[model samples]
Target: MDLSELLDDLIRFWPVDVDDVSLIGHSMGGLVLRSAGHHGYEAAHEWTGKAKTYVSLGTPHSGAPLENLAHQASAILAARPETNAFGRLLRRRSGGIRDLRAGSLVDSDWQGRDPDGLAAAMAAEVPLLPGVDHYWVSATLTRDPKHPLSRVIGDGLVLHHSAGGRNSTRHIGFTEDNGLHLGRANHFNLLNDARIAAKLVDWVG
Candidate 1:
């Protein structure tokens, strides 16, 4: 479902004080949280006003290079009949995967656009929820955060910079103190890392 539909479900099932709420999402889930928050904020939803924290783990705030490469590869393969079948397979990726190309969150990000088109630029910047603490966690596969390998092969799937929510032209406005970087770890490691758990406790426990 789209962000609007997901927001509708959240509104329907929310059963706590609208004055206080914490949102935590991992990977693509993080993008969903951002999208939902944006939708709620724009519509003046009660929950948006009270959202205290938003933590995104291993979210590709900037587009994922792997997906971008795959998107390009799919198109190139589709151009030739000899590899059209393989290209079709790659092109079969879900809308969610396509969204990852540029971390798209809202309908306008992809609305009226060609899904298979090579252009994967963000339609607009989705601002963070005002007055909410937005934190992000990133991981790298090298022991040192500054290592060149870590910079390029972050978490084996996402680039460290992308996970941190900053691109050349856009910044998610996360404060330095609100972010975490774990070296020698992969993306999934964010799910069960001790430091992350402790950080969560400190942030919202």
Candidate 2:
């Protein structure tokens, strides 16, 4: 769904004002913050007493391999400027995105284009505001039991390196019992899992 439309719906259904809100988002939701000029932060500032903490689950701080498919699709779409959803999705978010370059993950092209949410976020992500703590949860997905990721590090969909802040991060296993469970949790589980809801409340409190 469109970001604006989603937010509009949130405004209607969510009873909390900005100051009372604790904005939590996942992959595209984080990108939405950047695209919409960090509406999460703004909402937190307006409703909550502090800038909302952001934790990105499976959000590619560097960039995602999915972009490669998007770039290929854009080519198929006649190389229109930000006309494609995937391409436009990364651009509209933040600025100074370096992860979307050719061979980076998605686009895999050296060619350049206008600012994107991915780029914008990379540039402005540093020196996070007070009370605005951001965490990254990475996943490594693979069917191979002997896969290096399965053997070493990952949540399944995201690599260990992909989790955390752009310049800093904390890698947490979704499961507290094992760091190398070699299993993948759905993206939302990293944030809203049954085990972690209390933690989230504590963090937001």
Candidate 3:
């Protein structure tokens, strides 16, 4: 099933009350949370009203270039008989992976298209839920924030700009105070960083 459908099922069967609930999404989980709250989705309004805070950790909010590259690589490999099997395996990505191509938060973002093709032309900008305090955390491999490696291999997966919700065409516009950058950290570390955990506690509290 698609991420949206899975999210819908999750929300539908939620046992606890959603009022005042705060969501913390790491990596692709962040995208799922955003998708659940996108206006294009029916559940968006319901969750948005109850959600107090939205925190994303090392999420590819502007799409993951790595995945895009992988798609291209897979296609090329699949064309060759020698690596055809391996390439075919790579090409057979889950619906969730396809959705990540453009950080799609709505069904329409990837409803009917070539899963292997470039990201679909976005129909509209998906805005952040109003009244919900949105937070972003990004990590960098370099110790210095200004290091060239920091920009190129941000967290070794997602770029700092993308994770921090900085987009050129569309604005997620999370306040400076709501965003944090950690140096000498990789993508996986964001999940267990004591500093990040503390911030989440503080924010949720």
Q: What would the TM-scores of all predictions be? A: 0.90, 0.48, 0.82
Write one digit per residue (lDDT tens) for candidate 2, span 91-129.
443322344322122221324644322232222332233
Tell me how many clashing residue pairs each candidate has: 0, 31, 0
Candidate 3 similarity to native, TM-score? 0.82
Indicate which candidate wins on TM-score. Answer: 1
- Winner on TM-score between 2 and 3 is 3
Q: Single out the weakest 10-residue window by summed lDDT for candidate 2.
A: 172-181
Model 2 segments beyond 4 Å from truth? 1-20, 34-49, 72-127, 141-147, 150-157, 166-183
Ranking by lDDT: 1, 3, 2
Clashes of 1: 0
Residues 162-189 of candidate 3: C-alpha lDDT, one tens digit per residue:
8977666656667778989999999999
Over 4 Å off, model 1: 1-19
* lDDT of the candidates, in the order given: 0.84, 0.43, 0.76
RMSD of each: 2.2, 8.9, 3.4
